[model samples]
Target chain A: MVEAHSKIISFASYIPENYVPIDDFAAPADMPSKLDLNRITGLEGHRRSKENEGTLELALQAATKCIERSKVDVADIDLVINCAVGSLCSELRSKLSPSLANLIAEKLGIKGAECFDVSNACSGMVTSLMIADSMIKTGQINYALIVAGEHITALVDEARTNNLWFKSKALASLTLGDGSGAYLIGKSELPNQLVFSEPFTLARFNKLCVGEASKNRPGPMMRTKAAQLQQGVMGNLGEFFIRSMKYMDLDWEAIDHVYSHPTSPRAVKKGAGIAENTVGKIKRLHNESQDIANTASTSHCMLLEKSVQLNQLKSGESVILVSFGSGVAMLAMHFYLPEGIEQWS
Target chain B: MVVVRAWKSSSEKTTNLLKTICNLTQNLLSENGISFDDIGVIIHAGVYRRNFRTEPAFATHIQGDLKLKCGPVTQESNHCFSFDVSDGSCSPYVALNVASHMLRIKPEKYCLITIGDERPNKQSNWPYQPITCVMLVALEGAGYQLTGTNFDSSAFDSSTYVEMIFDSAKSANVIGESSSAAQINSDNSKFSGDTNWLSGRHIHAFLSQFTEGTTNTHEIIDQSGKTVTATWV
Candidate 1:
């Protein structure tokens, strides 16, 4: 018998068709008129979620694509992990029980699969992957589907309709967009198919951002110390990147493509510079935020799916994913795109 | 094999959620001759949170409050990884499965998991009293070694369920509107549990049996008829 390694068999992402232009947002009287949302967020517009659509629906859409691409029977899937931070369902109500994972499995007609939900802000997908990878290596399960559907723009709506102080505090919410992503992970004997560095949380910066229900409305809201969060993440980039490389035992130049947290184009560009200064230059660092802005937890996979559709990624090439979430949860994953990558296109 | 070294819990409501978890964690670590630095991972599992709060994992707050090695992960420094597992009543078992695999790869390192839930705020309606439970699991330990865990999730069993509902008057997501279709009594495979409280009460029952040295296996079934069963020494 061969030792098992978790490999990404298939992956897909979903972005809503509705695009909302930045100009559509009316600046609150209290917001500094000079605060340039475009230049700061590096976003021209973002995807708007359809009415009555929520996390479960978006996740199912992406999960369907991922499963279809895998060519594997749904009955063979033994695990389901939902990593959506915004777990809204049923009239956009924040769901607390019957976890999004269980609900997703039910909707997909997947039976007898172990299911659960993970919340680590935007690093959720990668964090859930770590668990699935560990379980596979331990001979616990055969296949696991890691999924996330972030119905995140409710925070944007909350910030838009609220008062002055609320708008200022929730400014980062403006960059949020709705999206979903899914990865079908299964056992493999090949090397470099999937590898993860130990995830760390710099909880000292935990208070830099927060998301909760609206004080004066019926939906979600977010407040962020945007500058401070960026500074903290960028300041630690050198060490995080170096450690990730070391753990995966990859030469800096071995990486072909890099996908980061996708908070903003400026932040990704700056953080990439800091990482390169500490290590070496990346071959291609992807920042697909201009049209869709930050898609929260689904950002990296969404970018990966886009890269595939554009023919930018070649089969058997090494790609690395780096992510940092609001909990200050951080991790990096290195993997090789499986054969038949062009099929996803 | 990974084992449960020690456990502690609190439900007095003397303080907020994070503080309660940290207090229990501190006591569990001290009593078991462990330290904050000894922990390699922390997983918080529950359903409800204060203010419907999302973003930072509640475990991060606990790790920060306990002053664990909450530093950047680097070659020269020690660090602790923390995240949250939200599986309603099945969280502890799910977290246990994840931690078991993690500890198996990193021999001798320990993982601390905290489980609990609370109403978001005062204006919001709360269904049950808030309670927090902490468990220390590790590979090189002398306690009940976890042998295995299995999960059976087939359908959407709404017999027992809960979801956030907006109270127009309060303008908040509260637990008041959340409902459980029916109460579940213990049988052979599933453990009896309260519909209002989350995993803390189920854990309490499991601990009671463990204390009496009567049961070697425990099971938790969520409102969805999904069940996770774990056997120990």
Candidate 2:
């Protein structure tokens, strides 16, 4: 029960205060009412960005809060990874003149940091965190700052307003909200709280979910077969969950909690059914999608942060972070929250 | 230490983007007397690409192009998954870092690191275009051990630059395997510290010397007057 790998030192998240309800989606009159939409989608509204907001800004806000909360000087941070560089929800998503991580490190006064950006759709933050974790575990760097920002409104805007992208059936974009999440992982004698981590991609299903720079619009737009994508993801999740439990010698019954990335309320419920099969009876933590649609890569961290803030997570507790996203990439992490961690900054 | 096999491929605008990556993978495997069956995973990095209009991960397309399959008949149970690592000029190094870690963990696995550059057809800073290099690194107990891997973003002189890399190597106790090579990406003004950068062709020639075998530890300077030392035992 005391076994662990890397401990999560600090966690922080930022969600834009702007709210855009389903009513503002510009759906046709034939579409379902607000109540039905809520009932069907399990989502009533999501956070949106105000004018002049972008991925870099949101990423900075999240990183700043994380660094500030960690009580560690910016100079002490050895590495900074921007997990939302190319996949961020902004018109400049594709543009990489000034890297997001480099800029953030500069502003934070982290002059001695090794920085890079890792983009793998929604599993990005975790992917970057894994890189930092490996670096720390391998003795390359001690402290790594991992951040992801999704100002995905531009794509949602393109899908809603642009005639070229006006595919009424493509509703995945409608569920996306804007937010950023950051985590600080350091190597210490404090025991390994982050036990197991892996990012696996099934290229066969990569086409199911993706975000790209819209041809007609300047910003990036995403198209996902919400139902079909959810099916593929659940199937993969079921396989990974069963296999991981065996590999890590974890008992489905002993597992304290299961936190999965939620795209929609309906999707969460459907995924929960899969969860039940593996663990018999499972406790699921998925409020990101419910509160802020699909925050893409930041979903896992945001969910973790929320849980920490609510005091739902306790020290020495075992939890599984299940994230599935674009490219159909699946990232599963096994963690033991260290004792004495106060709250998410 | 395992034997590291490297293969490089470059093309002009005339070459198809996908063909470049696919052919390079096949050729590297054939030259090494191995097949996709022997490989663990493929990691593709196309930091400079014009054919990204479809989707982000061209690694998937590369897997498809190479016709790699994972099933009951494929020898390996899990089909290897590929992902891109984008870090501008540092793309190959980043991919190498990831591959190194993978190989370190799964010693029986051979990770293929692929990087391509297809610059847009325009008069630009980077005269290099349509370049792809594949490095096959594994933990076969016979390949070059990447004794030290370094990434420094802050400002530094050439000594500091060399120290960031070599000091760690010294600490690791690897004095000099044979000859050390530096890829002075003249385009990286922050790190390269070059006033006039070298063309891709020139850098290509400099790296080709490694394959031909080196006589001594040489410090090869690109047209940008930036130095990168290369070593071959």
lDDT scores for all predictions? Answer: 0.80, 0.60
Q: Could you tell me the TM-score of candidate 1?
A: 0.95
For model 2, residues B41-132, the per-residue Cα lDDT tens digits are 66665444442332436676676567664221111246555566654445445566667655554343578777665542222233344446
DockQ of each: 0.71, 0.15
Give lDDT tens digits, candidate 1, residues A75-111: 9988899999878763757777867788788888788
What clash pairs does model 1 have? B51-B120
The lDDT leader among the candidates is 1
The deviation in Å at residue B74 for candidate 2 is: 14
Q: Point to the candidate with the largest TM-score.
A: 1
Q: TM-score of each model's B chain?
A: 0.87, 0.61
DockQ for candidate 1, C-alpha atoms: 0.71
TM of chain B vs. native, candidate 2: 0.61
